[model samples]
Target: MKRCKRVAVVLPVAAGLCLVYAPVAVADADASIVSAEVSGTLTPGARASVKVVVMNHKAPAGQKSCISAKMDGGGGTSCFDLGAPGTSVTHDGFMEVLKDAKPGPRTVTVNLLPRAVGGLGKDTKTVTATVGNAPPACDPVSLNRDAFQLGHTEGLKDGREDGFADSYRQSYDDAFKKKPGLTAEQCQDFALSAFQNGYGKGYETGFKEGQAKGGKVGEKEGKEDRQKGNTSRNVTIRQLRVTALPATGEADCAQGVKFTASFLGSGTGTIQFHWERSSGKVPGTIEFSGGDAEPKTVTDQAAVPAGATTATLTQKFVIDSGPSKGKTAQATANVTCKK
Candidate 1:
């Protein structure tokens, strides 16, 4: 007897949806099979039935046709001859679970191969059914008070172990059913090792979640601390000055203007001074001494061109380091020429 080939089958979980896999038809006008389904207790040696609706684009109703169906890993192919455009045709493709079938989910595949000139291409569908073993019978038991309390604790432990084992077993079974590549022993080992390390699995999950939350909290706290420190240091700009001096020949002959910036703060840091002029001269930057209590000053000079009537100098002072970083002040001076 020829044994059926085992293949992966992905079934739809939605109600009234069939797991159909149909290739492009070779026929001029394609025919199709839809709503193919399997129904039966998947227990070992149980009877089962498969049904589908056959449709043909060119064939009229009442036309006789042949179709075939087969399981994924069990009995051989079964064929049926039925009328065209049939509804719920239970063709000769009835199914039966083997006596040695294991207790787990099994894939049942049905292929609709019709024999017609320029027939519709092969249409295949699959479904999953759970094959179960006979459940063990419960035995009567009587326990004293201490035994009852101990039993309660043991029951909780047993429950968790059983759940863990079952979860791994189900996962392995699903993998096998989808691709029967793993031996039974391999599948069992996978489940057993996973169940044995349940605590490690739980710790890994918890650790990642805790680390992410801690990282966010730590980042927020660090920003707040920096702000508090900067506020406490209290950095300030004390004064700014601009002076213009002309040559001896003319009071307003014009030469250059001097810019100064002074800083005052309790925080020890570097102060950056930026100088600008209304005469469209190139701007310049300079550094000044900065620290607690004592004032620090920096200066820059901008040349005045011949046609320039007035000189406007602007200075911006910024604390560039320590807790007082980002604090800034500005000053401007205007010098008029005598005509």
Candidate 2:
């Protein structure tokens, strides 16, 4: 033991031991829906395809993720798996517009779930799809034809009334001159003119109505009707009378005198006439349309002869054509001359 102790115990001092600790790196697990789109026309009772894209910000190793979509009204939920970190995945599906669906924009919502034990909360995205109007169902050709026939019938009625007024006016004029009224040929021309005018107006109105009821076909038929301008029949007229306003007395020399002629009639057509004054004749014309039973008037002025203290003037209204043709109505006025 003494010898061993003296041998200078060479048991090497155990080398000082050092321990180091390091932090473990954990991966981030976050996923989100990037976008969603719906393609194809979305008419009622029609189907359209849907597309959704999802992106993951970071993914834990071996983690699973999924994206899903649901439409606002009725399409069921659809899902697809997501890719790795910093990558995007696309999901495709289809949706249908209900037969009774209202026209306008509809929405689809998409959601993303990381599926990892501890990942970011669910991410959501929305897309819009438009629903269009349904196609028309009526027979367009039949609608257009009905419109034309309606217009023609109404036009004939209007044309007859107008034609009658025209012929009646001519008959009155001829009768006033003790001559025969409108010839067959002349009467036919008048009827044709009236028919064309009435038909054109009625056709336009009916065509527009038809277009509202029949769509494109109605428009095409309307154009054809306008180009036709077909002709038809004619008719007659009734009474006429003229009266003078202020038929008794008046005054003012420098300012002259004013006279008015009023005519009342129950028919249509143009009338030719003249004013016969103590001075001269003034020619004129007046027209009537429809079954106007109202009075129409015209005016004229006369000057007092110079140097005359008291002046008496006479004015006459004469019809040159129509049932009252050649008939005359007269009036007198007394004026005080101013120097």
Candidate 3:
């Protein structure tokens, strides 16, 4: 009868069973240029000291962050490693100004490349440096050739993207309306048509843009070169036009109305102008440094009264002083406040 009393013993199970954990990976975040500065006389064939401050925005701890600075036109690039999130690093480097570099302001671009995670970001800042004397007489042949090439490259890129988008949208819409689901052959055909259309449009756009750009460059350079030594030339307003947004439709009262004034001028002097509005007037001026008749635009906004349900806005661009004084162009917009 005593054998009925039995005891059970329990052993530790944690030691017998092993638990394993995989390490978690952290993704890198974009870094940004907080501030950038370039100093020293940037003369031809000289080096200018550059200082850049970079900050990591949201990268987790232990993530690798880097930023590189490259001059816009041409120069060696400098890169630096950054610290954790909310941390900033300062990098000091030198940028060389090419002997043939153009005078005036130049741009320096900063690129952020996260190492741990694949991501890219960039920012640009400008530093004005006098690389050389006022641009020497631009050679017509050389200017035209360079401008043509630049225009063609830019136009081709833009046109190809636009054409592809248009073709793809049309093809997708057409295929979607078919009786059955889109087939693989239809998809192939869509892609082929898109690419062919893109190529054709790109070539046509590139040629036209190249010719137009070349003409404009040639005309501007020719005029500037011709009037370089003539400081006594008086500015003359050659053309003036004004346009208003929502010219005859309803618009938000708070959002206001916009007016644009475009004018073309010739000669080297200052042109005094003013915007005459239904409510008030604003005085403005434009300085023409070269003799070329370049087109310039000025924009103005008209605000509606807080309680006004409907209003008529009128704006006039007037030439106050110059040979073309008294010349005026005006536009009117009728707006109704949105409910």
**TM-scores for every candidate against the unseen true structure:** 0.28, 0.30, 0.32
The candidate that wins on lDDT is: 3
C-alpha lDDT score of every prediction, in listed order: 0.44, 0.51, 0.55
Better of 1 and 2 by TM-score: 2
Report clashes for each candidate as comma-separated counts: 0, 6, 0
A best-first ranking of the candidates according to their TM-score comes to 3, 2, 1
lDDT of 2 by residue, 1-339 (tens): 000000110112223212121221222336655666666446565565666655656754335655454655446355555555665655665666677877766666655555557655267666666666754443434433544454466754434434433444343333333422344344444444444544566544554453243333323333333345311111122333334333333345766667777666555556677999766799997777646464677777877787777677777887765434455666677554433
Output the worst ten-in-a-row residue range by lDDT, candidate 3: 1-10
Better of 1 and 2 by lDDT: 2
Candidate 2 steric clashes: 6
All models, RMSD in angstroms: 33.2, 41.3, 30.0
After superposing candidate 3 on the true structure, give the runs of residues whose Cα lies further than 4 Å from its correct spot.
1-233
Model 1, residue 325: what's the lDDT? Answer: 34
Off by over 4 Å in 2: 1-250
